[model samples]
Target: MTGRSGGFGDHSLKTLEESRKTYLQSLRVSTADATFFSHQNALRKFFSWYSPTANKPDSPGNTLAEFAKHLLTTLGQSVDTVAGHIHSLLNFLAFHHQSSPDELRVRLFSEIQLLSCPESAKESLSKEFGFQAGSEITRSVDALRAYLRQRQYGTRTHAYVELILAARARPTQIRLLNRSDLHLDEQTASIPLSETYLIAATGLHNEQTVDLPPDLTNVLETYIEHERKTPSQSGCQPLFTTIHGRASVGTLRRSVKLASEKARDYHCATRETNPDDRSPVDSVTAVVPSDIYRVALSDVENTS
Candidate 1:
């Protein structure tokens, strides 16, 4: 349900356009020419988006949420900008004797207000938020760091390790991430944009940038250039790819779990062979491979 106005090869969309024009004539809205033009354009867009499918009738209900998401993530429009478009949409719905988009508009408007907040304000809000405050863990962050530093890393394995270490992302997040999403030069990586809006709505984050460490950036570059496949080769252009497409969650999980296990084993061997060794190794070796969760929990605490 997306195309240029009058470009839909059918008269129904054209009929909708005529209907919209009639509605505007009847609306007596206290708006200027520019505002009227904007509303007209918004109507055109909505009809274009709501045009019937090949085998099915037009179902605006099925597409409204999707359209809003496309506006937020794909178009990357400011919340206010999108809200303006939605207001016009409400008018269009009213004209059609359809239920207004009030609830959906409220949700979309809330999301926009969140995105519009200053970065400092977002940080302040997160800090002040008490609902998500997590219990403090006893895990040693230094130990986690040491384990990460000592682990062996092939180009592919290293990329996953570094991203998880830095992103604190779940294995599921890797496959959803596109090759184009990594911002190496910026030293910041965005999580999936689809996830970002939800994050903002939930007040977990402000949809601002998330930082990536230099070492992680370097590894990702090496993997993308040397190891990852192009879309033509794999059918999906993901930063991390398998023969099929994006790396599967299992594949991503296995590498980290294996690496962490290896790190723990080495730590255990060191502690056993030299029980009293006065090295950072003693403190670091206490954590098991399974302790990765505690590390992630710690990151969530620190960031939130």
Candidate 2:
């Protein structure tokens, strides 16, 4: 009947208008005095819909239980979330009215019990209540790194994962490395080598003038001359470069992974075949093993 053309007569509409004015004034007063403006507004709206008498402290048919239920249903919140909100509202109302928490209605009292528990305990209880937490080991840092490394990760990409793992273990710093970080000298050759070459000469780190076996030295010299030459082409870096002519972390990671896999494959194939076997030639045993190749280089340097 509040200023509407309904079944109510003019007298009823006038009473409704007066009630609306009084309710608005009450809301304004409560909003001014309320500690939380949001809570005051919500309570004011609820009171307006349920009870129009503003001056009375107690309103007929105003129950905290019904209000809590209405709030939860209207908000479409989970049980735990609804319980927390109701508990907060109950506490706020009790404090505003200068009453004890115990004086709150049963619905809010029950919610307060649920909210008072420690978060860890509540999670445990929730699990016990059949709320399963989503968890997977496949998404772990190590697992993801391994997968990416297999797919040929670049240097920068590997560095980032390494940083994350290091941080997880303990706080640490990652320093950038450059070619200058490597110690290189003509006098000493700490180059890695294969077992066959190591058997021929003793290895030393940063040693000068290691003699290399003539044959191995010649092969190495040829390889270096052909493959390690300074590029005549513009925009090319010999030490490292991407297909597009730029060094990248992903490219480096992928190269190392591919190299390792090739080495492993060669080792396995050689191990399975007999050197004295008269069968057709094995492709794996035909290629130089990483260890043997490295030893050949060391032997060449040592003999030379």
Tens-digit lDDT track of model 2 for 64-90: 434444555565445664444444344
For residue 220, model 2's alpha carbon misses the true position, in angstroms, by 99
lDDT of candidate 1?
Answer: 0.49
Q: Summing lDDT over every window of 10 consecutive residues in candidate 1, give the lowest-scoring window.
A: 1-10
Against the true structure, whose lDDT is highest?
Answer: 1
Error of 2 at 60 (Å): 11
lDDT of each: 0.49, 0.33
For 1-304, candidate 1 gives per-residue lDDT tens digits of 0000111235365576676766666443544678668877776666665645444222332234345545666767665665567666644543343222322232233333344344543343233221221232222334334455565433565666556556654345545777666788988766632232322222322222357777777777777768776554634467776776677767766765565556556766766688685555434333322344335434442332
The per-candidate count of clashes, in order, stands at 1, 25
What RMSD does each model have against the real structure? 16.9, 29.3
In the predicted model 1, the residue pairs found to clash are 1-49
